[model samples]
Target: MSAIEASPAQQATVRMAARALGRAGLVHAYGHCSLRLNHDYLLVCAPMPPGLIQREAGVVVPIRGELPDGVLGEVRIHQQIYARRNDVGAVARSMPPSVMSLSTAGITPVPRHGPGTYFAPSAPLWDDVQLVRSTPQAEGVAETLGHARAVVMRGNGAVVVGATLEEAVAFTWFLEDAARVECAIRAMRLENASAMSAEDAARRATTAGRVIERMWDYLSAGDLELNSSHA
Candidate 1:
């Protein structure tokens, strides 16, 4: 396929990932998701709220160039990340409530639980609340992410990347769950709640036995498109 054209299955996967992020409460009206089509392009979902997207709605965007006419401005975040991280096949920009709430305190979730271990020591913090609309701003966000699976934007939400679209979706959920736990710990005043050791977190962070796939299946289970042949 050409860099500008995505097959039906690829388009369906992008739609499914967007909807899953929405249904899981990880995103709302302002978020977007994209999957890399190749080294040169990516397919981003329609600009509307993720949950409200329907049919084959996506635009193929070049990885290194001016944003396409109809693409959202912040999609530059995806473009920048795709340009820097060849390992990342998909990207999600989400506003999970707990993640946003925790980030406001200048904190990213600690590795205090099983799902949290995937992020290990902690997800990096962008320390910026501004929307990443410019190329420079998007580059800053992607640089903050580095080799991490996710990066929390202070009071702005988060950006998650994965080796595949499913892994990206699963990691988005995991990041939020970790933040939820962190919020609960703070609420209970458990300031001493111990975090998993780096050694232990590394051991537990493996993607063995369909760990990520299972989470993706659970999150996308109710999507009719994913259940159909298009999935």
Candidate 2:
């Protein structure tokens, strides 16, 4: 697949998404986000902490080939995922504190709240603590994600996907909030706390009424780069 150049607007959006994840505390010094340019290529944030990426244009890499020099090793996760999931147009690698803590105990957040419903019954657990730096490992993680919106890596972090970059960022926040609810319930020893029924979750898991757009606005509200652009 031939690489495509990411426009300045696309680069800005990717940077803003990275900053949003960092500002929301969903990621710290080890996370990334990418926007799919098409089936053949994606534009990933610079090889730095997502929060600190400013004025740096993203790297455009082919979805099916070896990662270009200067791309992070873990970016292979994005590569394999884009290769497998055509519906996904963006991907976020985040490590929300609550989500991370819960996954260490082999638990993925259950849909106990409205935000949780976006993940439906629950986010799948990848059950691995290792970083996804190898082709086979990345493929395995993407396979575990399946058609789900997110996947929790055991004691590592998570991967969230969406039809757009903004939606992916919003889902990262939603996943963290769901984890927060689950952690609170478990901490209170609420063994009887009921998770949303499958039917109920299906009903509640919607993007109606600008739910995702509102979140994206909130997260990107103060982003100077994004605010300065008309894209």
* Candidate 1 Cα errors over 4 Å, as ranges: 1-3, 227-231
For model 1, what is the error of residue 20's alpha carbon versus the real structure, in angstroms, after optimal superposition? 0.5
How displaced is residue 55 in candidate 1, in Å?
0.4
Worst 10 residues of 1 by lDDT: 222-231
Write candidate 1's Cα lDDT for 1-231 as tens digits: 334688888888988998999999999888999999999999999998998888857999999998878789999999999999999999999999999998999999989999899998999999988888799999999999999999999999999999988999999999999999999998999978999999999999989999998998899997868754254
CA lDDT of every candidate:
0.91, 0.92
Q: Could you say which candidate leads in TM-score? A: 2
TM-score, predicted candidate 1 vs. hidden true structure: 0.96
Candidate 2 residue 154 Cα shift, in angstroms, is 0.5
> Highest lDDT: which candidate?
2
Clashes of 2: 0
What would the per-residue lDDT of candidate 2 be over residues 84-189, giving only the tens digit for each residue? 9999999999999999999999998889999999998889999989888899999999999999999999999899999999999999999999999999998999
